[model samples]
Target: MDLERPVQIVWQGPFTLAAAIASSTAPSKGVYQIYGQHIVFGPNSLLYVGMTDGQTFGARLAQHRDRWLVHEDDVTIRLGVVADLDSSARLADIEALTIWWHSPPYNSKNIWTYGGGPLRIQNLGARGRLHPEYSSHWKPARTPPDGEHP
Candidate 1:
């Protein structure tokens, strides 16, 4: 399950799609990390983790421009090119692993009481095995209103 690979610094420091165009590190496909100010777990200060297969990292970043964190001026972006060909599944797996590990607020599909705080899961199965307490925490993700996408 290790997707360890070298990642280039595609874009950083209050990222915007317009910035990606000026930077040479922009990658066409791979994983991306969105960092927020507060540290949630360990030394990793991540707000979201995402993967791009058929789209450019710039395009993907643009899609998230209106997210909650976008309102923050300190948010940054880092992108890595998918080194392996035909590794879309692996990239998806890595995305899940990252979200589970960091539990970023925006990734929360379902909120559960865990570790004396709320736990968010973008993909429950990706969480793999869990402690017995989590069984009681299963909750569905909130649906957006009337054709809106959250």
Candidate 2:
């Protein structure tokens, strides 16, 4: 059986509090990722993956403007629209799969249970972090020159 892959990032960029609030393209319903160059999870950077159904991306992103930023000046947002996952259940599945694959610092790595049972597991690491369709377009995180701190 073939395993699913990581969600694709359709759009991504560094944003400030004011920029995030003003961006109109982020007002869609989908999954989002927040990456920070801080020590939230550990020394190897941090990525926070989340999803939104009823709430628009713009609104949800705006909410994070307050406390989500571990590094005020070093934060980037990656937005991925799960076209296949038009339902809430599918959205949650994608979110869970992403968390499992990347094991981002901000996400829980514990066994996820639901409806009095364990959540179904799948192999999502086959295609790397971003979904296969968008994986080719994936750009490694920008790093400092050499001696410069990230």
Candidate 3:
């Protein structure tokens, strides 16, 4: 193996990534959330939504590498950082938006269920983009009083 030459090593695994602050709780108090795109490599190539409040792009990636846990498959991941400094919210909105957009199956994390039962699970891996909006297990809550934070 030559050190100077690039090598291709493939593996699949689980990841416990430590993300940089996606959106600041306080837009005025903190750096406005910069919306951007990053890349992730694994047995399954996934493009996820991400935003940050700081400039520790490389370090944030390093945290992903360090915390990721190998599953039945060995997976390697990489991220390319971009910025969108106009919004107060972080990547959560994008995550939900994309999950509803793509609807990929077998990816359960997108369901965002804290754990209840089958009714709580959702089809997260939809490549064809069919968002029918099923599951009525949860109810919507009314907004808090004006100028009040929930």
lDDT of 3 at 59: 48
Among residues 3 or more apart in sequence or in different chains, the pairs in candidate 1 whose N, CA or C atoms overlap within 3 Å are: none
Cα-based lDDT at residue 147, candidate 3: 68
The model with the greatest TM-score is 2
Question: Cα lDDT for residue 86, model 3?
Answer: 31
Candidate 2 vs candidate 3, lDDT winner: 2
Poorly placed runs, candidate 1 (over 4 Å):
1-18, 21-25, 38-44, 67-69, 109-150
Tens digit of lDDT per residue, candidate 1, span 25-122? 56656666776566444332566667777877776777787545457545666665544434565555445544445456667632222222222222
lDDT of each: 0.48, 0.53, 0.30
For model 3, the stretches where C-alpha displacement exceeds 4 angstroms are 1-44, 47-50, 69-84, 103-150
Candidate 1 residue-pair clash tally: 0
Cα lDDT tens digits for candidate 2, 45-107? 446778777877778877877665634446666666654444577667666555544556666
Candidate 2 displacement at residue 1 in angstroms: 13
Q: Residue 44 CA error for candidate 3 (Å)?
A: 4.1
Each candidate's number of clashing pairs is 0, 0, 15
RMSD of each predicted structure: 10.9, 10.1, 17.0
* TM-scores vs. true structure, each candidate: 0.52, 0.59, 0.31
